[model samples]
Target: MAIVTSKVAGHAPGQPRGGVVQMARDSWVVARRNLRRMTRIPEIVVFGLMQPVMFVLLFSYVMGGAIKVPGGGYREFLMAGIFTQTVAFAVEGASAGIADDMTKGLVDRFRSLPMARSAVLAGRTLADVVQSAFILLVLAMVALLVGWRVHQGILKALSAFLLLLLLGYAFSWIGALIGLSLRSPEAATSAGLIWLFPLTFLSNAFVPVNTMPGWLQAIAYWNPFSATVQACRKLFGNPGVDGAHAWPMQHPVAASTLWSLLILALFSWLSVRKYRNAVG
Candidate 1:
Protein backbone atom coordinates (compact mmCIF):
# COMPACT_ATOMS: atom_id res chain seq x y z
CA MET A 1 0.00 0.00 0.00
CA ALA A 2 2.83 2.43 0.96
CA ILE A 3 4.75 1.76 -2.28
CA VAL A 4 1.61 2.28 -4.37
CA THR A 5 0.88 5.52 -2.54
CA SER A 6 4.44 6.83 -3.21
CA LYS A 7 4.03 6.21 -6.97
CA VAL A 8 0.69 8.04 -7.03
CA ALA A 9 2.16 11.04 -5.13
CA GLY A 10 4.98 11.29 -7.68
CA HIS A 11 2.43 11.94 -10.45
CA ALA A 12 0.04 14.05 -8.45
CA PRO A 13 -1.79 16.88 -10.18
CA GLY A 14 -0.32 20.45 -10.01
CA GLN A 15 2.99 19.23 -8.67
CA PRO A 16 5.71 21.73 -9.54
CA ARG A 17 8.37 20.59 -12.02
CA GLY A 18 11.12 21.81 -14.29
CA GLY A 19 10.65 25.43 -15.32
CA VAL A 20 12.48 25.00 -18.62
CA VAL A 21 10.68 21.80 -19.56
CA GLN A 22 7.34 23.36 -18.76
CA MET A 23 8.17 26.43 -20.75
CA ALA A 24 9.24 24.29 -23.70
CA ARG A 25 6.09 22.21 -23.66
CA ASP A 26 3.90 25.28 -23.45
CA SER A 27 5.89 27.09 -26.15
CA TRP A 28 5.63 24.17 -28.56
CA VAL A 29 1.85 24.14 -28.25
CA VAL A 30 1.64 27.89 -28.80
CA ALA A 31 4.04 27.88 -31.76
CA ARG A 32 2.23 25.02 -33.46
CA ARG A 33 -1.16 26.69 -33.10
CA ASN A 34 0.09 30.03 -34.40
CA LEU A 35 2.00 28.51 -37.32
CA ARG A 36 -1.03 26.52 -38.38
CA ARG A 37 -3.11 29.69 -38.42
CA MET A 38 -0.44 31.54 -40.38
CA THR A 39 -0.24 28.77 -42.96
CA ARG A 40 -3.96 29.08 -43.65
CA ILE A 41 -3.76 32.86 -44.11
CA PRO A 42 -2.24 33.53 -47.53
CA GLU A 43 -2.88 37.25 -47.53
CA ILE A 44 -0.96 37.80 -44.30
CA VAL A 45 2.01 35.89 -45.63
CA VAL A 46 1.98 37.75 -48.95
CA PHE A 47 1.78 41.17 -47.39
CA GLY A 48 4.48 40.44 -44.83
CA LEU A 49 6.74 39.02 -47.54
CA MET A 50 5.96 41.66 -50.16
CA GLN A 51 6.38 44.78 -48.08
CA PRO A 52 10.09 44.27 -47.43
CA VAL A 53 10.93 43.13 -50.96
CA MET A 54 9.02 46.03 -52.53
CA PHE A 55 10.68 48.55 -50.26
CA VAL A 56 14.17 47.27 -51.02
CA LEU A 57 13.64 46.98 -54.78
CA LEU A 58 11.83 50.28 -55.22
CA PHE A 59 14.01 52.38 -52.94
CA SER A 60 17.33 50.84 -53.96
CA TYR A 61 16.82 51.10 -57.69
CA VAL A 62 14.59 54.12 -58.19
CA MET A 63 15.88 56.49 -55.52
CA GLY A 64 19.12 54.82 -54.43
CA GLY A 65 21.14 55.44 -57.60
CA ALA A 66 20.86 59.19 -57.24
CA ILE A 67 21.87 59.05 -53.54
CA LYS A 68 25.63 58.49 -53.49
CA VAL A 69 27.65 57.08 -50.61
CA PRO A 70 30.69 59.20 -49.86
CA GLY A 71 32.95 56.57 -51.39
CA GLY A 72 30.60 54.64 -53.66
CA GLY A 73 27.01 53.71 -54.66
CA TYR A 74 24.35 54.00 -51.98
CA ARG A 75 22.30 50.90 -52.76
CA GLU A 76 24.74 48.45 -51.18
CA PHE A 77 25.17 50.65 -48.11
CA LEU A 78 21.44 50.98 -47.49
CA MET A 79 20.35 47.32 -47.62
CA ALA A 80 21.18 46.73 -43.96
CA GLY A 81 19.16 49.80 -42.97
CA ILE A 82 16.17 48.56 -44.92
CA PHE A 83 16.46 45.11 -43.36
CA THR A 84 16.36 46.55 -39.84
CA GLN A 85 13.33 48.67 -40.60
CA THR A 86 11.47 45.78 -42.20
CA VAL A 87 12.10 43.47 -39.26
CA ALA A 88 11.03 46.15 -36.79
CA PHE A 89 7.82 46.68 -38.73
CA ALA A 90 7.04 42.95 -38.64
CA VAL A 91 6.24 43.38 -34.94
CA GLU A 92 2.95 44.90 -35.97
CA GLY A 93 1.45 41.56 -36.94
CA ALA A 94 2.40 40.00 -33.62
CA SER A 95 0.90 42.94 -31.82
CA ALA A 96 -2.26 42.59 -33.87
CA GLY A 97 -2.63 38.92 -32.98
CA ILE A 98 -2.22 39.63 -29.29
CA ALA A 99 -4.75 42.42 -29.43
CA ASP A 100 -7.13 40.26 -31.42
CA ASP A 101 -6.91 37.39 -28.97
CA MET A 102 -7.56 39.70 -26.03
CA THR A 103 -10.47 41.44 -27.72
CA LYS A 104 -12.07 38.13 -28.70
CA GLY A 105 -11.78 36.87 -25.12
CA LEU A 106 -9.57 33.97 -26.17
CA VAL A 107 -6.94 34.84 -23.60
CA ASP A 108 -9.55 35.13 -20.89
CA ARG A 109 -10.78 31.69 -21.83
CA PHE A 110 -7.24 30.32 -21.55
CA ARG A 111 -6.90 31.86 -18.12
CA SER A 112 -9.65 29.53 -16.87
CA LEU A 113 -7.63 26.50 -17.93
CA PRO A 114 -4.97 24.77 -15.83
CA MET A 115 -2.02 26.13 -17.83
CA ALA A 116 1.01 28.21 -17.02
CA ARG A 117 0.27 31.93 -17.07
CA SER A 118 3.50 32.92 -18.86
CA ALA A 119 3.18 30.26 -21.51
CA VAL A 120 0.96 32.09 -23.98
CA LEU A 121 2.96 35.29 -24.03
CA ALA A 122 6.36 33.62 -24.22
CA GLY A 123 5.28 31.04 -26.76
CA ARG A 124 3.57 33.56 -29.04
CA THR A 125 6.70 35.71 -28.93
CA LEU A 126 8.81 32.73 -29.95
CA ALA A 127 6.41 32.06 -32.79
CA ASP A 128 7.00 35.61 -33.98
CA VAL A 129 10.74 34.85 -34.05
CA VAL A 130 10.07 32.02 -36.49
CA GLN A 131 8.07 34.33 -38.74
CA SER A 132 10.77 36.99 -38.56
CA ALA A 133 13.41 34.42 -39.49
CA PHE A 134 11.52 33.44 -42.64
CA ILE A 135 11.16 37.08 -43.57
CA LEU A 136 14.92 37.57 -43.06
CA LEU A 137 15.71 34.67 -45.38
CA VAL A 138 13.47 36.14 -48.07
CA LEU A 139 15.03 39.56 -47.59
CA ALA A 140 18.51 38.01 -47.84
CA MET A 141 17.62 36.43 -51.18
CA VAL A 142 16.38 39.79 -52.43
CA ALA A 143 19.56 41.51 -51.25
CA LEU A 144 21.62 38.87 -53.02
CA LEU A 145 19.73 39.52 -56.24
CA VAL A 146 20.54 43.19 -55.80
CA GLY A 147 24.27 42.29 -55.47
CA TRP A 148 24.56 42.52 -51.69
CA ARG A 149 26.69 39.79 -50.11
CA VAL A 150 27.99 39.02 -46.67
CA HIS A 151 31.75 39.41 -46.86
CA GLN A 152 32.04 37.93 -43.36
CA GLY A 153 32.47 34.16 -43.29
CA ILE A 154 30.00 31.59 -41.93
CA LEU A 155 30.41 32.29 -38.18
CA LYS A 156 30.10 36.07 -38.36
CA ALA A 157 27.24 35.80 -40.83
CA LEU A 158 25.36 33.49 -38.49
CA SER A 159 25.99 35.88 -35.59
CA ALA A 160 24.70 38.77 -37.67
CA PHE A 161 21.54 36.85 -38.51
CA LEU A 162 20.98 35.91 -34.89
CA LEU A 163 21.42 39.54 -33.84
CA LEU A 164 18.80 40.63 -36.33
CA LEU A 165 16.35 38.01 -35.06
CA LEU A 166 16.96 39.05 -31.47
CA LEU A 167 16.34 42.65 -32.39
CA GLY A 168 13.06 41.60 -34.00
CA TYR A 169 11.98 39.60 -30.96
CA ALA A 170 12.77 42.52 -28.67
CA PHE A 171 10.60 44.80 -30.74
CA SER A 172 7.93 42.13 -30.69
CA TRP A 173 7.86 42.40 -26.92
CA ILE A 174 7.27 46.12 -27.17
CA GLY A 175 4.44 45.30 -29.54
CA ALA A 176 3.10 42.81 -27.00
CA LEU A 177 3.02 45.54 -24.38
CA ILE A 178 1.05 47.81 -26.66
CA GLY A 179 -1.26 44.95 -27.57
CA LEU A 180 -1.94 44.00 -23.99
CA SER A 181 -2.39 47.55 -22.78
CA LEU A 182 -4.59 48.97 -25.53
CA ARG A 183 -8.37 48.64 -25.26
CA SER A 184 -9.08 48.05 -28.92
CA PRO A 185 -7.42 46.61 -32.02
CA GLU A 186 -7.92 49.83 -33.97
CA ALA A 187 -6.15 51.82 -31.29
CA ALA A 188 -3.30 49.32 -31.15
CA THR A 189 -2.86 49.33 -34.93
CA SER A 190 -3.00 53.11 -35.15
CA ALA A 191 -0.60 53.58 -32.27
CA GLY A 192 1.90 51.04 -33.63
CA LEU A 193 2.05 52.64 -37.10
CA ILE A 194 2.25 56.12 -35.68
CA TRP A 195 5.04 55.21 -33.28
CA LEU A 196 7.07 52.97 -35.59
CA PHE A 197 6.80 54.87 -38.90
CA PRO A 198 8.46 57.96 -37.53
CA LEU A 199 11.10 55.95 -35.67
CA THR A 200 12.02 54.04 -38.84
CA PHE A 201 11.91 56.84 -41.42
CA LEU A 202 13.57 59.50 -39.30
CA SER A 203 16.64 57.30 -39.06
CA ASN A 204 19.11 56.47 -41.88
CA ALA A 205 16.84 53.98 -43.65
CA PHE A 206 17.53 55.45 -47.11
CA VAL A 207 19.54 58.66 -46.74
CA PRO A 208 22.63 59.38 -44.70
CA VAL A 209 22.00 61.01 -41.35
CA ASN A 210 24.80 63.56 -41.86
CA THR A 211 22.92 65.04 -44.78
CA MET A 212 19.99 65.90 -42.51
CA PRO A 213 19.73 68.99 -40.29
CA GLY A 214 21.81 69.00 -37.07
CA TRP A 215 18.88 68.10 -34.81
CA LEU A 216 17.77 65.30 -37.12
CA GLN A 217 21.33 64.00 -37.35
CA ALA A 218 21.57 63.86 -33.57
CA ILE A 219 18.29 61.95 -33.32
CA ALA A 220 19.12 59.54 -36.14
CA TYR A 221 22.58 58.77 -34.84
CA TRP A 222 21.19 57.99 -31.42
CA ASN A 223 18.30 55.94 -32.74
CA PRO A 224 18.58 52.24 -31.84
CA PHE A 225 17.40 51.20 -35.29
CA SER A 226 20.29 53.16 -36.81
CA ALA A 227 22.63 51.44 -34.38
CA THR A 228 21.33 48.04 -35.49
CA VAL A 229 21.59 48.91 -39.20
CA GLN A 230 25.15 50.19 -38.75
CA ALA A 231 26.07 47.06 -36.85
CA CYS A 232 24.66 44.79 -39.55
CA ARG A 233 26.53 46.81 -42.22
CA LYS A 234 29.80 46.13 -40.42
CA LEU A 235 28.93 42.44 -40.08
CA PHE A 236 28.09 42.22 -43.80
CA GLY A 237 31.20 44.29 -44.69
CA ASN A 238 29.07 46.87 -46.46
CA PRO A 239 29.86 50.57 -46.50
CA GLY A 240 28.28 52.53 -43.63
CA VAL A 241 26.70 55.95 -44.16
CA ASP A 242 29.91 58.06 -43.88
CA GLY A 243 33.07 58.88 -41.95
CA ALA A 244 31.32 61.75 -40.17
CA HIS A 245 28.81 59.24 -38.79
CA ALA A 246 31.43 56.52 -38.29
CA TRP A 247 31.14 56.79 -34.51
CA PRO A 248 27.64 55.25 -34.62
CA MET A 249 28.82 52.51 -36.96
CA GLN A 250 31.95 51.73 -34.99
CA HIS A 251 31.59 48.69 -32.67
CA PRO A 252 27.90 48.73 -33.46
CA VAL A 253 27.60 44.95 -33.54
CA ALA A 254 28.03 44.79 -29.76
CA ALA A 255 26.30 48.07 -28.88
CA SER A 256 23.17 47.26 -30.83
CA THR A 257 22.99 43.79 -29.30
CA LEU A 258 23.24 45.20 -25.80
CA TRP A 259 20.56 47.76 -26.52
CA SER A 260 18.30 45.07 -27.96
CA LEU A 261 18.74 42.77 -24.97
CA LEU A 262 18.11 45.59 -22.52
CA ILE A 263 14.92 46.63 -24.22
CA LEU A 264 13.68 43.04 -24.38
CA ALA A 265 14.33 42.42 -20.72
CA LEU A 266 12.46 45.56 -19.76
CA PHE A 267 9.49 44.72 -21.94
CA SER A 268 9.35 41.14 -20.74
CA TRP A 269 9.24 42.31 -17.14
CA LEU A 270 6.44 44.74 -17.84
CA SER A 271 4.36 42.28 -19.88
CA VAL A 272 4.58 39.58 -17.25
CA ARG A 273 3.61 41.99 -14.51
CA LYS A 274 0.66 43.31 -16.47
CA TYR A 275 -0.50 39.81 -17.33
CA ARG A 276 -0.27 38.59 -13.75
CA ASN A 277 -2.21 41.60 -12.51
CA ALA A 278 -4.86 41.05 -15.10
CA VAL A 279 -5.15 37.41 -14.17
CA GLY A 280 -5.27 38.13 -10.45
Candidate 2:
Protein backbone atom coordinates (compact mmCIF):
# COMPACT_ATOMS: atom_id res chain seq x y z
CA MET A 1 0.00 0.00 0.00
CA ALA A 2 2.79 2.43 0.88
CA ILE A 3 4.65 1.80 -2.38
CA VAL A 4 1.49 2.09 -4.42
CA THR A 5 0.56 5.30 -2.61
CA SER A 6 4.00 6.81 -3.27
CA LYS A 7 3.78 5.98 -6.95
CA VAL A 8 0.28 7.37 -7.21
CA ALA A 9 1.34 10.55 -5.45
CA GLY A 10 4.16 10.87 -8.00
CA HIS A 11 6.60 11.41 -5.13
CA ALA A 12 8.40 8.14 -5.57
CA PRO A 13 12.23 8.16 -5.87
CA GLY A 14 12.30 8.01 -9.67
CA GLN A 15 9.14 10.01 -10.38
CA PRO A 16 9.20 13.55 -11.67
CA ARG A 17 8.58 16.32 -9.13
CA GLY A 18 5.14 17.93 -9.28
CA GLY A 19 4.68 21.67 -8.91
CA VAL A 20 3.68 24.84 -10.80
CA VAL A 21 6.81 24.60 -12.92
CA GLN A 22 6.01 21.06 -13.96
CA MET A 23 2.47 22.05 -14.80
CA ALA A 24 3.78 24.88 -16.98
CA ARG A 25 6.21 22.58 -18.75
CA ASP A 26 3.49 20.00 -19.39
CA SER A 27 1.23 22.75 -20.69
CA TRP A 28 3.93 24.01 -23.07
CA VAL A 29 4.41 20.52 -24.50
CA VAL A 30 0.68 20.25 -25.11
CA ALA A 31 0.54 23.76 -26.57
CA ARG A 32 3.43 22.90 -28.91
CA ARG A 33 1.56 19.80 -30.00
CA ASN A 34 -1.52 21.87 -30.89
CA LEU A 35 0.63 24.47 -32.64
CA ARG A 36 2.24 21.77 -34.74
CA ARG A 37 -1.19 20.46 -35.60
CA MET A 38 -2.18 23.94 -36.73
CA THR A 39 0.86 24.03 -39.00
CA ARG A 40 0.12 20.63 -40.50
CA ILE A 41 -3.45 21.75 -41.14
CA PRO A 42 -2.95 25.15 -42.74
CA GLU A 43 -6.65 25.35 -43.55
CA ILE A 44 -7.25 26.12 -39.85
CA VAL A 45 -5.35 29.41 -40.14
CA VAL A 46 -6.67 30.25 -43.58
CA PHE A 47 -10.30 29.75 -42.63
CA GLY A 48 -9.85 31.85 -39.50
CA LEU A 49 -8.45 34.70 -41.57
CA MET A 50 -11.15 34.56 -44.23
CA GLN A 51 -14.16 35.51 -42.08
CA PRO A 52 -12.54 38.63 -40.63
CA VAL A 53 -11.22 39.72 -43.99
CA MET A 54 -14.66 39.34 -45.49
CA PHE A 55 -16.18 41.33 -42.63
CA VAL A 56 -13.62 44.08 -43.18
CA LEU A 57 -14.36 44.35 -46.86
CA LEU A 58 -18.07 43.87 -46.58
CA PHE A 59 -18.54 46.60 -43.97
CA SER A 60 -15.95 48.93 -45.43
CA TYR A 61 -17.72 48.94 -48.79
CA VAL A 62 -21.27 47.60 -48.55
CA MET A 63 -22.37 48.90 -45.16
CA GLY A 64 -19.92 51.77 -44.78
CA GLY A 65 -22.04 54.08 -46.89
CA ALA A 66 -25.20 53.48 -44.85
CA ILE A 67 -23.74 53.83 -41.35
CA LYS A 68 -22.76 57.19 -39.90
CA VAL A 69 -20.17 57.51 -37.13
CA PRO A 70 -18.86 60.42 -35.15
CA GLY A 71 -15.20 61.60 -35.14
CA GLY A 72 -14.13 59.43 -38.11
CA GLY A 73 -15.29 57.64 -41.25
CA TYR A 74 -17.17 54.36 -41.04
CA ARG A 75 -14.05 52.46 -42.02
CA GLU A 76 -12.14 53.62 -38.93
CA PHE A 77 -15.13 53.01 -36.68
CA LEU A 78 -15.69 49.55 -38.15
CA MET A 79 -12.09 48.42 -37.64
CA ALA A 80 -12.30 48.22 -33.84
CA GLY A 81 -15.60 46.37 -34.05
CA ILE A 82 -14.03 43.94 -36.48
CA PHE A 83 -11.08 43.43 -34.15
CA THR A 84 -13.27 42.65 -31.12
CA GLN A 85 -15.56 40.32 -33.08
CA THR A 86 -12.63 38.30 -34.41
CA VAL A 87 -11.10 37.66 -31.01
CA ALA A 88 -14.44 37.14 -29.31
CA PHE A 89 -15.24 34.44 -31.83
CA ALA A 90 -12.27 32.43 -30.53
CA VAL A 91 -14.75 30.91 -28.08
CA GLU A 92 -16.30 28.87 -30.89
CA GLY A 93 -12.98 27.41 -32.00
CA ALA A 94 -11.95 26.61 -28.44
CA SER A 95 -15.22 24.87 -27.72
CA ALA A 96 -15.15 22.83 -30.91
CA GLY A 97 -11.51 21.87 -30.45
CA ILE A 98 -11.98 20.77 -26.85
CA ALA A 99 -15.11 18.84 -27.67
CA ASP A 100 -13.33 17.12 -30.53
CA ASP A 101 -10.61 15.93 -28.20
CA MET A 102 -13.11 14.73 -25.61
CA THR A 103 -15.23 12.75 -28.07
CA LYS A 104 -12.15 11.24 -29.68
CA GLY A 105 -11.04 9.64 -26.35
CA LEU A 106 -8.11 12.04 -26.16
CA VAL A 107 -9.08 12.90 -22.64
CA ASP A 108 -8.53 9.29 -21.64
CA ARG A 109 -5.05 9.36 -23.10
CA PHE A 110 -4.22 12.55 -21.21
CA ARG A 111 -5.59 11.10 -18.00
CA SER A 112 -3.26 8.11 -18.22
CA LEU A 113 -0.23 10.37 -18.25
CA PRO A 114 1.51 11.42 -15.02
CA MET A 115 1.12 15.05 -15.94
CA ALA A 116 -0.81 17.95 -14.46
CA ARG A 117 -4.47 17.62 -15.36
CA SER A 118 -5.00 21.35 -15.68
CA ALA A 119 -2.42 21.41 -18.42
CA VAL A 120 -4.89 20.02 -20.94
CA LEU A 121 -7.20 23.02 -20.83
CA ALA A 122 -4.39 25.50 -20.22
CA GLY A 123 -2.42 24.31 -23.19
CA ARG A 124 -5.44 24.39 -25.51
CA THR A 125 -6.41 27.92 -24.47
CA LEU A 126 -2.82 29.13 -24.87
CA ALA A 127 -2.66 27.73 -28.38
CA ASP A 128 -5.90 29.52 -29.19
CA VAL A 129 -4.40 32.79 -27.97
CA VAL A 130 -1.40 32.38 -30.24
CA GLN A 131 -3.62 31.56 -33.18
CA SER A 132 -5.85 34.53 -32.40
CA ALA A 133 -2.78 36.78 -32.30
CA PHE A 134 -1.70 35.66 -35.75
CA ILE A 135 -5.20 36.15 -37.11
CA LEU A 136 -5.31 39.60 -35.51
CA LEU A 137 -2.07 40.54 -37.27
CA VAL A 138 -3.52 39.56 -40.62
CA LEU A 139 -6.80 41.32 -39.86
CA ALA A 140 -4.91 44.48 -38.85
CA MET A 141 -3.22 44.56 -42.22
CA VAL A 142 -6.61 44.12 -43.86
CA ALA A 143 -7.99 46.96 -41.75
CA LEU A 144 -5.12 49.18 -42.87
CA LEU A 145 -5.79 48.38 -46.48
CA VAL A 146 -9.35 49.59 -46.05
CA GLY A 147 -8.12 52.96 -44.74
CA TRP A 148 -8.37 52.26 -41.03
CA ARG A 149 -5.82 54.56 -39.38
CA VAL A 150 -4.84 54.68 -35.74
CA HIS A 151 -5.27 58.27 -34.68
CA GLN A 152 -3.83 57.45 -31.31
CA GLY A 153 -0.09 56.76 -31.09
CA ILE A 154 1.38 53.30 -31.53
CA LEU A 155 1.51 52.64 -27.75
CA LYS A 156 -2.19 53.28 -27.28
CA ALA A 157 -3.10 51.18 -30.31
CA LEU A 158 -0.94 48.39 -28.97
CA SER A 159 -2.61 48.71 -25.58
CA ALA A 160 -6.05 48.45 -27.20
CA PHE A 161 -5.06 45.29 -29.04
CA LEU A 162 -3.67 43.86 -25.78
CA LEU A 163 -7.00 44.41 -24.07
CA LEU A 164 -8.76 42.68 -26.96
CA LEU A 165 -6.39 39.73 -26.63
CA LEU A 166 -6.97 39.63 -22.88
CA LEU A 167 -10.72 39.56 -23.48
CA GLY A 168 -10.20 36.77 -26.01
CA TYR A 169 -8.23 34.76 -23.46
CA ALA A 170 -11.04 35.15 -20.96
CA PHE A 171 -13.55 34.07 -23.61
CA SER A 172 -11.65 30.85 -24.31
CA TRP A 173 -12.32 29.71 -20.75
CA ILE A 174 -16.04 30.02 -21.33
CA GLY A 175 -15.57 27.84 -24.40
CA ALA A 176 -13.54 25.35 -22.39
CA LEU A 177 -16.42 24.99 -19.97
CA ILE A 178 -18.89 24.57 -22.82
CA GLY A 179 -16.77 21.94 -24.55
CA LEU A 180 -16.20 19.89 -21.41
CA SER A 181 -19.87 19.99 -20.49
CA LEU A 182 -21.22 19.21 -23.96
CA ARG A 183 -18.73 16.36 -24.69
CA SER A 184 -19.59 16.44 -28.42
CA PRO A 185 -17.78 18.54 -30.95
CA GLU A 186 -20.82 19.08 -33.16
CA ALA A 187 -23.05 20.14 -30.29
CA ALA A 188 -20.31 22.29 -28.82
CA THR A 189 -19.78 24.07 -32.10
CA SER A 190 -23.48 24.87 -32.51
CA ALA A 191 -23.97 25.76 -28.85
CA GLY A 192 -20.88 27.96 -28.81
CA LEU A 193 -22.11 30.10 -31.70
CA ILE A 194 -25.66 30.27 -30.40
CA TRP A 195 -24.76 32.29 -27.34
CA LEU A 196 -22.08 34.30 -29.11
CA PHE A 197 -24.42 35.69 -31.77
CA PRO A 198 -26.67 37.44 -29.27
CA LEU A 199 -23.71 38.61 -27.20
CA THR A 200 -22.01 40.21 -30.17
CA PHE A 201 -25.03 41.52 -32.02
CA LEU A 202 -26.93 43.03 -29.09
CA SER A 203 -23.86 45.05 -28.21
CA ASN A 204 -22.39 48.14 -29.95
CA ALA A 205 -20.26 46.14 -32.37
CA PHE A 206 -21.83 47.11 -35.67
CA VAL A 207 -24.26 49.79 -34.53
CA PRO A 208 -24.38 52.42 -31.83
CA VAL A 209 -26.35 51.59 -28.68
CA ASN A 210 -28.33 54.80 -28.92
CA THR A 211 -29.78 53.57 -32.17
CA MET A 212 -31.25 50.64 -30.25
CA PRO A 213 -34.52 50.96 -28.35
CA GLY A 214 -34.35 52.52 -24.85
CA TRP A 215 -34.48 49.27 -22.87
CA LEU A 216 -32.28 47.47 -25.38
CA GLN A 217 -29.91 50.42 -25.33
CA ALA A 218 -29.38 50.02 -21.58
CA ILE A 219 -28.52 46.35 -21.97
CA ALA A 220 -26.09 47.03 -24.77
CA TYR A 221 -24.62 49.93 -22.83
CA TRP A 222 -23.78 47.78 -19.81
CA ASN A 223 -22.68 44.74 -21.80
CA PRO A 224 -19.16 43.51 -21.10
CA PHE A 225 -18.79 43.06 -24.86
CA SER A 226 -19.66 46.69 -25.36
CA ALA A 227 -17.22 47.70 -22.66
CA THR A 228 -14.36 46.17 -24.62
CA VAL A 229 -15.59 47.65 -27.89
CA GLN A 230 -15.93 51.08 -26.36
CA ALA A 231 -12.51 50.79 -24.80
CA CYS A 232 -11.02 49.86 -28.13
CA ARG A 233 -12.67 52.81 -29.86
CA LYS A 234 -11.41 55.19 -27.20
CA LEU A 235 -7.91 53.74 -27.27
CA PHE A 236 -7.83 53.58 -31.04
CA GLY A 237 -9.25 57.10 -31.27
CA ASN A 238 -12.07 55.93 -33.50
CA PRO A 239 -15.73 56.88 -33.41
CA GLY A 240 -19.09 55.21 -32.48
CA VAL A 241 -18.85 56.40 -28.90
CA ASP A 242 -21.86 55.56 -26.73
CA GLY A 243 -22.92 58.82 -25.11
CA ALA A 244 -25.02 56.89 -22.61
CA HIS A 245 -24.68 57.62 -18.92
CA ALA A 246 -23.74 54.00 -18.21
CA TRP A 247 -20.59 53.46 -16.19
CA PRO A 248 -19.15 51.08 -18.78
CA MET A 249 -19.30 53.70 -21.48
CA GLN A 250 -18.02 56.46 -19.17
CA HIS A 251 -14.93 54.56 -18.09
CA PRO A 252 -14.55 51.91 -20.75
CA VAL A 253 -10.93 50.97 -20.20
CA ALA A 254 -11.42 50.22 -16.52
CA ALA A 255 -14.72 48.45 -17.15
CA SER A 256 -13.23 46.38 -19.92
CA THR A 257 -10.19 45.43 -17.84
CA LEU A 258 -12.25 44.47 -14.83
CA TRP A 259 -14.82 42.57 -16.87
CA SER A 260 -12.10 40.59 -18.64
CA LEU A 261 -10.28 39.72 -15.41
CA LEU A 262 -13.52 38.69 -13.75
CA ILE A 263 -14.53 36.50 -16.69
CA LEU A 264 -11.07 34.95 -16.83
CA ALA A 265 -11.12 34.08 -13.13
CA LEU A 266 -14.70 32.81 -12.97
CA PHE A 267 -14.75 30.73 -16.16
CA SER A 268 -11.26 29.35 -15.60
CA TRP A 269 -12.32 28.01 -12.17
CA LEU A 270 -15.53 26.56 -13.62
CA SER A 271 -13.69 25.02 -16.58
CA VAL A 272 -11.05 23.32 -14.46
CA ARG A 273 -13.69 21.95 -12.12
CA LYS A 274 -15.82 20.72 -15.01
CA TYR A 275 -12.78 19.17 -16.71
CA ARG A 276 -11.97 17.12 -13.61
CA ASN A 277 -15.51 15.85 -13.28
CA ALA A 278 -15.88 15.15 -16.99
CA VAL A 279 -12.77 13.01 -17.11
CA GLY A 280 -12.65 11.66 -13.57
- The top-ranked prediction according to lDDT is 2
Q: Residue-pair clashes per candidate, as listed? A: 0, 0
lDDT of 2 by residue, 171-222 (tens): 9889989999897899998888898878988899988777788999988988
lDDT of model number 2: 0.88
How well does model 1 score by local distance difference test?
A: 0.78
lDDT of candidates 1 onward, in order: 0.78, 0.88
Model 1 per-residue lDDT tens digits across residues 41-68:
8687778889889988888878887886
Model 1 alpha-carbon miss at residue 175, Å: 0.7
TM-score (all chains, Cα) for each model? 0.89, 0.93
lDDT of 2 at 240: 80
Determine the C-alpha RMSD for candidate 1 after optimal superposition of all C-alphas: 4.2
